[model samples]
Target: MNGHADVGPLTSLDLRLQWRAAATADLADWAALIARTAAVERPVWFERRADLEQILASKKNPAAANTILGFDPEGVARACGRITRNPEGEKAIGFGCVDPGWQGSGIGTGLLGWMEARTRQRFAADADAGADGGSGAAPRLRLHMEQQHTHQAALFGDAGNRIVRYFNEMHRPLQDGFPEAVLDGGLELVTFGPRLHEPVQLAHNEAFRDHWGSEPRNEEGWGFVVNDPLARPDLSAVVVERASGRVADYQLASHDAGSAESRGYAEGYTDLLGVQREFRGRGVAQALLADAMRRFAAAGMDKASLDVDSETPTGALALYAKMGYVAVSTSMVWDKDL
Candidate 1:
């Protein structure tokens, strides 16, 4: 995609603001910016170009304006960010980073302001078109930042955002044997496959309905996960009810051995885990997790990781702790009403 027609000037930092829809060509620069920013903020964080590419591809609507890039006078990328609106158009998710060398130079703040403005303008137009189906309520702007990154938290806080929720990145070593998949009668454990996508998607939406700030997953969002190159369909687990033959719970696993952010470790990430409301009391959730962990171990992964809402109503944090997972990092979701 081409850069936005109007290239605004950021005279203070000798940088020009360019609003652009991200393309495959920008993956390398985006990955580099993510790596550099992570190194300076959270050294353990790792991002891959392929991951970014998959996300951009999932947007599907090529005409949607969602990305902004800032460049130095020398044509070098100095900062970048993107805004993603939920299918319901009630929320906008944003994230961006400034070059390590350019921190404290107002570049990061300027980029955030630009993104927020863009989000507001887009949502305003959608509102005028009755895009929200006549809700007429203003959309909320949301952004996530590592709790340890006080500077980022401060920057957003200064802009009137408040911490709305916290999430923990939990990890567990796989050297120990994983628990055997234990399922109650009439529940069968199976691997993810083509026919199970829709059922799994519906179950996921139902499971996350009570989650903070959760939006139902649309077709494009579901496609993004299943179509990801790194997604291990064979390694992912799905628990189905025998009577109705429907997916009750699922665990989607992914791994990229070549990811520089992984720090050379063979890590299997449980991208999404969900259990339908009716299946909560049963052992379906635990069974799906155990089967996933077993698959990761069979793949010779050194560890497994996943993120959970710290205040999940399902007591997920406590459940994970009981399963030998420990918090490795913490992040907060900040929100501002638009």
Candidate 2:
């Protein structure tokens, strides 16, 4: 029997809600559903099975089950949701999507409600286990949606979620060429290598600590980055502090060949860019971006893309703008106390 067999039916449709924990076999179906939904909800975005696999493998809190699928009586995956708790269990990140055909039929809302309840239950268990014993407030629940999905945003709003953050999906045309990267006196640039993965991961966590909704990555999460088949280590760069010989900043890049082909242009993606707090103002970020652009150009890519918070403390959006990146799309983060 399906896990959600006992759940009530969706009011607007004849579909009975059936729940199940996602397994390795579900990757293809999940990717297919995401693609089908994105074709209408977010045409510019691409979802891949590898990415889904990585997400499933990188569950931060193993004891807190998060992946839940809502299926129809016919065993079709009509909706899915996942909630990932941070290490401290003080915050949980939630995301879900409904099959476009069933979107307005209330599957999305039902999935979200189920995810919220599951998250709360997990948080309560964590609290009882002394994981979040000291904090008096309930864990924060957050979800992200593309800004263009106004209807979905309205639904989330009606469900008591408020906008908390906005992110710009920025793109730069590499065919136009790029400026020379200037490194400060105390910093040295090095190509990404297997040896630098651990240090880079540590520096990334440190750098992103102050960012809103940021969470430190564990080994599994870090592995998802380094082990990804699309990662172009040769095109990526890391800046090391000459004095301390520590990773001060880094850029991890990837080449999405399918996406590039779909768009009729070769493109490189800047998957992650982070600079240590103490090294922020020393031109580290600009240098890293320039290096990535240069590499993309050399690789015959027509464009490079990355996403940044609009309200980033590091002025990342402005910096990307200065580097000739333009906003192609925007996504919003919705949050509520759970």
Clashing pairs in 1: 46-261
lDDT (Cα, tens digit) per residue for candidate 2, span 1-338? 35533222223222466667677888888788788787677555555788777776764544126677666777777777777775464578887788888877766777767767876766776778776655644867888888778888888998899998888888899878796769989899999999998999999999998887677777877887898868899989999989989999999999978766557888789989998988888898999999999899999899989989898887888889999999989998888887
Candidate 2: where is the Cα deviation over 4 Å? Answer: 4-15, 43-46, 59-64, 133-137
Model 1 lDDT-worst window of ten: 6-15
lDDT of 1 by residue, 1-338 (tens): 22555322222222354445456777787788787777677544455676687666654333236666666666556688777776455777887888888888787777777667766766776778766667666867889888778899889999899998989999888997787657988888888999999999998898889888777888988887888778999889888889999888899998876653447678789999988888887877778777778888898888888999998898788878878888989999998887
> What is the Cα-based lDDT of residue 253 in candidate 1?
90
Tell me how many clashing residue pairs each candidate has: 1, 1
What's the distance in Å from true for residue 218, model 2?
2.2
TM-scores for every candidate against the unseen true structure: 0.90, 0.89
**Candidate lDDT (C-alpha), each:** 0.76, 0.79
